[model samples]
Target: MVEIDESHTSLPVLAFFRSPQAGRSWVTAAGLVLDTANLLFSALDVPRSRQVELTFTAGCLAVNRVQRFFDKKAETQPTELRTPEEVAAANPGREAFAKVWQELRDGGLPVRPDEEAAWQHYQALRMRYAPSIEFLSQLLLAPAMGSLH
Candidate 1:
């Protein structure tokens, strides 16, 4: 067994990489949806650029689904806010957001279709209304195989 050093700055990231059952259920569910989206879209005779667009769109949907699940969970369970402020108060600086993102990704909750659609629209607005911030967030949370695995 790889003894994961919990003290590492990337501990939250490692938490996400651990067994799929341990953390949030949303992450795994979103991953499944993304995989399905990829498979479904790959068969279409779309242009490469279109395919990439579709993939990014699907990913946006999947992430929104995850967010909805967490939102609902927060409503029912009423856990502490995992926002940057709260996380920063505990861990400080980038480490806080990193940890929160890891927690959100590892939670593995299920997102509904409606929620996914809403998220897509929200993402579009963000892209249009606040391109720089949206782009920065994307840069911060660049998807990687390890995040899903």
Candidate 2:
């Protein structure tokens, strides 16, 4: 039983085997978040921005790789049962991601640490571009489009 916050990057990968569509959605959501963070950080450091976005992107990439692994595995399913043994087979991407996600799981996701410097920078960015950002974020979170849950 994997426990993850709604915004956790691993959320998508965890859903991969169980619900591929959901997993894909999580990946897309992660991409949007990463892209936003990168765009924000390009002009300025934004304090903890680098840490936050990097962590998210790392999770996203790892999960995506794992998802690709599963897709390949599904294609080569030896038995209709799709046993755990099949899933445990050698897959470089999945193996690497498993290790990282495991550590993250054990330690707990960063959950946006409260570093004063980072927060101040983030606040300044938000204040400077509140309206534009709000509009863009709204597009990202639009309910009608079936956003990441």
TM-score of 2: 0.29
Give residue 52's lDDT in candidate 2 (0 to 100): 68
What does candidate 1's lDDT look like per residue over 1-149, in tens digits? 01222221223333234343444332333343443343233322234366655554655553553333333533322233245542333212334323433444456532222433433443343342122212222222323212211
Worst 10 residues of 1 by lDDT: 1-10
lDDT of 1: 0.34
lDDT of every predicted structure (CA atoms): 0.34, 0.36
Per-residue error at 63 for model 1, in Å? 0.3
Quote each prediction's TM-score: 0.26, 0.29
Please list all clashing residue pairs in model 1, or write none if there are none. 24-106, 24-107, 24-108, 25-107, 25-108, 25-109, 26-107, 26-108, 26-109, 27-108
Which candidate comes out best when scored by lDDT? 2
Could you tell me which 10 consecutive residues in candidate 2 have the lowest summed lDDT?
140-149
